[model samples]
Target: MQISRLPRFIRYASALALAVLALFAAMRPAAAAPAHKTEGELSYSSHSGLTNSADGSTGTASTGFQVLLPDGTTRDVNTFGEAIAIAGEHRGSTITLFEPVTLSYTVTVPDGTTINLNSQGGVTYAAISGSSEPPLRVESGSTVAIVNTGATQVARVQNPNGVFAIENKGTLLLGSFVQVLVASGGTAVYGNAPQPAPGAFIVDAPGSSRVSAVQVVQPENQTAAYSGSEGETVVDLLAYVATADSGVTVPVFQLRDKPAEDPTTPSGAPDNEWVLATGPGGATVSDADELVTGDYTFTLRPQGATGDYYGYTVTLTVSVTMPQTVDELRETYRQKLAHALAAYAEADYLADDWANIEAAYQQAFDAINAATEETAMQEAVAGFQTAANLVPTAAERLAAEQQRLLAELDQAYAAYDKADYTAEGWAEITAAYEQGRQGIASATSIADAQAAQQAAVSAMAAVAQKPADPGTKPDTIPATGDPAAIAALMGLGGSAMLAVGVVARKRG
Candidate 1:
């Protein structure tokens, strides 16, 4: 009957149940284990001299230069005699050469390195005793260029492909011909024609290349001039167009040579000798006017020895296209808006005519930007046209206003001269008129002149009525101390008193 003695089956069952619970708890999935990562450090050991290395920053140590690797690791370079040895560093790490770098030994430019060289500095390679070529070689995809600004500066490169460009605007004298080798997708620009004095250089496969300076053959009566051959007298015109996007500015066309424009001289010819005319394409050679989209030709006829027109004919075609696409329209609209705003800024905004025109233009431009349909755009265009007609152009209005102000100033002068006013009044009026005249003279626009005119008018009216001079003021009576004057006054008083007494007595 005592509970202390449990049945054998019950005790065994309890034990088994406890064991099953423990097994289930162990089978449950454990919390996700933290991800494990491997980290690498830039190992540095100086074999020859003391080397200072930075792990995550750029610094200079007695041994070498240390740079932070892209992988959050630090690399310390201890030896930097000529060009620092960085071939063992990251693949795409950039090494900037701030000073002249000498490659006494073979130095391979890591792939995708951007090597910026000083214009005044240069890169030279030492010729190995046994090798016929310089020890330096630039790897493909390595970009190199000179930082020189003027054409006078020069950049010399030992390995061509190592530098992307020889010189952007300056001269580039290659130590070896490899300098002209452009990268796979890079361009090599030579400041001028590559001359061969040391040796002829070969250019490897570059995506593209450009020469800043090239000699253009002048147009002649015949190709045989200076030579002894008869051929067609033909000339090619450099194509020109004036349209820009994203606020970019394009150079204008010049109908002359690059350096020398005087064609009559030995180096050039007179620009007027050639005439530009509308070709069959109906295009005109106008710089200010938007040319019609078509072909334009330039024709020139030289006088022959016989005093007759030469049989040769020369022509050039120019194609013009107006804005038609949305982008083009937007750019054109911005240009027009700038022009209109400049004019409006110079106009007399206080005047109803100018203000109205300006407001209309602003509204039209706003509508143009807000319009989503062609009809709305057309409406805005029409509105702008109407507003333009409401007032004269900015220049015309300013000129006319100045003329009117001048006339008004002259009239004011005449009125001041004719008016019969005192000197003081005249001074006030003249002062006002002079101030107004000065304003008008210095006025940049019509509003300024109008304001000046008002000032003059106000001055003229500010003069009060002409003052009249009272005749010399009577002298004050002297002290009544003179006996003669006192007697006279007493006699007059007695006479007046006697007459008054007689009249009073008679009336009584």
Candidate 2:
């Protein structure tokens, strides 16, 4: 029994020793890994015309925004303008403030119709109980839009929803910022009218801006002007009656809520949505996504050639969504890349296309950080490097992307050089080049992409040193240093050797 136990102990001790060695190996920082992993910021967005099929109470059409955050192994819908978590390939991971933001939405609820806390932006945080969630916000101003779009021709205002006084809509005070302006599309028809594809309109407010709701439109009286200064707290509702398609004359805005102000006769104020619209001048209310965030007042008034006449009213309920996620970011990136590349491809294409150059490279990096599969990361890297090299000039190549890739290459090459730029050195460079190549498919044209792929294959062939027939030497050998240029030259030979360790370590 003692002898048998002794053998078992020795085996156990040996196993422990192997584990320590493996751990030490693991701790050595992944050989030539890039200094900074941008996996969290990379993404691939496709506008499948799929429109976010998922419905929300907000009623806005969907934006085909999908994202692959860093450290995450899966892909998901980047809803509510929230940034995808960047740390892992798993869902619900976070990348902090690093995610690029691109969201613009506006929601207009009809007058007398009340919208609640469910319409504010940055809905990604912990919930809070309150008498007021203060969700409504108007971007760049003090007044909010009160757009009326209801089946009955009017979404009436629920009186006294959340009242606050304001100067003109533009003063944009410090605490409560409320300003009234005509929304580009009053109704924001998500399912009906046009404009925003599916999501709501988003507003951008730097800080400390406030928009109030249901403020009175003061007469020419001193109190009729500003809110902070002894001015009357009023609703600034600018109304434009579509006199024609290319032109619209500002109409009369009826004054409401002044104690002395009479409802029967117009007091030179704007039109309040007192009665349902039944004529050609009727308003249409559409759904918009995340608008600005804060308190707001929406006033509607019709205008005409004879000064401002009494028009109808419309109240809008707006929603503010924040952290605009990677989908929007991808859209922005795609557009910029296309524009930049188009410019770079000109016969006299001399510009570096730096903006897109960085974005494309970053996209590749982000893909790697977010993807869990080693294959995915390697492919993403390869594609990225390919795109990075296509920008047509060395000036463009001197950018951050180049610096980063070069740095990583330097480290990898250094490792190889340490091993004597031998077969292993060539193998490592080959891997780096392959990783960079994989990132190009989605980033460039098919013709250009195929060219890159062919180039890569030829490179592999050269590295492996094959003959016309596996048994005989080729007519020509690949040149040295240009591992990817071709394999027909006498360059360091090794492709199979490089991919072996990666496959064993990651795929296995």
Candidate 3:
């Protein structure tokens, strides 16, 4: 079929119509939703001038001195602030003060400073303040207060809680109190380092200082360190005895020792004799001996709960002295006592002899006693402590325990000799007593006193029944085993153990 072509103008007209329709369709998508229109400038008025600012961001504004609502505008402000706010924009615009404003200030008139008359607020003295804090203002309804007994400043208040209208810099005079707290970053207004108590201000925090709180400090006392060359000499020692479960007290000591001892005056015999000893409760060391012209070790220990304690270290020192045997010591003591006694006999010449007499008595004590660790009071206490087994056999703890026991044993023998025994016959009897005491005091937690008694009896029996010492015997019964000696050996062990047990229980 022959296609009849329409006129060019007609075709053009159709094409134009289609183009127009397409355009309308595309435009419809954008035009269908209405957009918000730009309104007129916002109106704002304030009597306080411009007091704040708003920073603009993303075509939106941040807060400023004064605010204009509709157009998102603002103005600067100074004082009696007043503003009319309106909301039109979707964004959150902020209004801020020009700077960190001074909340308030307090001026303290130090004592003796003559306070002059003032109108309002505190004294503004540029001489003292330099360029730091601003002058304080007394707001309306606020009264100027003085700490001391004088009128320091004045206040003019128009309305309650309103600012006190100040005129100019000439409003303040000299010698008036300066309100430090008025300016931002101002020096702290302090009457003094805050007093501890019964004062004007109290710090909220416990230990804070910095003019915010009170503090007490004293100068430390420092003593000159001891150098062996000059001061008085002394000797000290420490020993410990505790059960396996008990806490340990270590010695804190500058231990000293003698490499060699001076020989006796007549030649070969040992002189300046020494021995280790402990103090009451095993807390400190005392009476250390066995010296030459040299060094000796000393130590200290601390007390603890029944089972827990710490050892301490201490320096023990003794001055170099002439050699002396036990016999010599006894003789010296005798002479001293005799001299003192003779003086006492002379009524007019008698001086206080209590100390000298005691010394003499102790000297005589030496003659009557063999000086065994067994009878030592402290050693006895320690001996009973051996049962505790707090430390193993291999460690120094064992050696220390044995030492303590030996000291007791020595003391015991000494006592036995002085009591009913003799130095010559002091033998198995003493050993037996020590063993018995050891058994009674062992850490096993015996059921009752009967058990303890039985243990003591058994220990005594052990010594009594011991086989004869086949070799080397004593020269004197008094030195070995006299009747007094035997009886002492028999009873001391158990008695000591019982005493120890009592002490332990009391401590607990």
Candidate 4:
């Protein structure tokens, strides 16, 4: 009876221990799981024309902007902030815009990344945060149109650090409604606008005939008179209203002779009637014959119907001198050509690139020498300047060559197999690689560095392969053993040795 009671106690004790272990597990906190890294591409596409019929949806599907992740998955994003958040999570990702859209909110691009706007892509009516290391790049062939609507300015690029923040290589269309402020170290490579000042911006269109603020010389008093030469282009008198409180239409103005009393109508005969002209930024006088030596009063208003005047009006006097002489035009061309040649000499191009530069200079020289008109000589000088700007400097060429050599050396080292070659051959390959590495590190010229890299590659190709080992046997055998048995044992031993050799070769 005592023994039976002892077994029951032991069973009760085991149950109590199991209960205690369960309680401890329930009270302890669980370990946290590791976070997943967000990587790869995140693309944004606005389904511009897709309908519900294509998606087989019962109701109207939301045709807003959708983001495609790297894992071949996509989700609809409602705001620009959502898209930016998704893009920021993916390290070193590219944001591709598929359709034209206006973002009302501010876009802060991540560091060391690019936002590519395709042919049909554009962004306007938004503020882009400035960056120096990772610039706000406007790709070629894309048109980024900035237009003001009422009191709101089109776009504002803020760079307080005074670094180059905007890199515009494409077309930037600026309407006459507002001044798109791009302050502090903004670069425009392919536009007609002038270089940006420290606090002011440049409005540039590569092929458009619009006159920007850079071309206009505005005095302190609005009623002041401006003078120009007789041969000056009519665009010189055009005025661009730089304000942010108007619509998208260009300014329209009427030019007429200054009146004596009223100042609205011409003081002379009826033949001196008002000449009407219109343009996107300012009025363009197509015929130069209309511009005579006279004081003109022009009234500027926003382009609209007959009775609507959305913008302000301006009246000014313009005086033109007699047409320039032929000798004066020739002297002007000579001065411009001299300046262009000086600039060409200052551009420190690579040694090999000098041939192209010389050829361009010779062509410019011949064209200017034979040119009879001022326009032809100016064109030749402009062409030469453009050619000179395209050549890379000596330092830039050397850096590129060094990068190429380093990449090739890395590939060679990754593909090398040490076990396939003999010990002596592997040593030779290692020495060659070290020599190439040292040469690249201390190289001052492109040619010497390339030679060193080539030598290492050649040495790697000449590496010798290891020879297979042949098995051997003892000369004497025991006389007491059977001849057949001895022969079988020897054959088995040889087979085993060969198998070991094969295994060793594979392991190597």
In model 1, where do residues sit more than 4 Å from their true spots?
1-88, 119-133, 139-152, 158-508
Per residue, candidate 4 scores C-alpha lDDT tens digits across 1-508 of 4545678879789789999999999999999888754542333233433222322434233333344455545544554455557756754444433333343332444433333322121124223343433234444544443322221112233333443334455554433222333344443222433233221234445443222211111223333234456655444544322222112122222222111222222233221111334322354446343344444444443343333222234333333334546667666676786777677553467656877887787788778777778788889889988987788777678778888997898798767778756789788888888888778767878888898899888777666555433463535552333344466578889999999999999999
Clashing pairs in 4: none
Query: Taking the tens digit of each residue's C-alpha lDDT, what string does model 2 give over 1-508?
Result: 4545678879788789999999999888656856864334323343222222232333232332233343434333343232222212233332111111222222221122111111222212111111222222322322222221111111121112132111122222111111222122221111111111111121222231221122223322111111121221211111212112213222233222221123223445443332112211233322221222222233334443443332234443212122324554444444544444454433332344665566776787577556555556557656766786666553333343444443543354343332324566467557745654563333234344445545544444344321234576545543455444355332434666667778898976
Tens digits of per-residue lDDT for model 1 on 338-371? 5655655434444666777767777888887776
Task: Tell me the deviation in Å of residue 198 in model 1.
Answer: 26
For model 3 the local lDDT of residue 463 reads 40
Q: Report lDDT per candidate.
A: 0.44, 0.33, 0.32, 0.49
lDDT of 1 at 108: 48
On lDDT, the leading prediction is: 4
Q: What total of clashing residue pairs does each candidate reach?
A: 14, 112, 85, 0
* TM-score ranking, high to low: 4, 1, 2, 3
Which scores greater on lDDT, model 2 or model 3? Answer: 2
Return the lDDT, model 1, position 493: 82
Model 3 misplacement above 4 A: 1-426, 444-452, 462-508
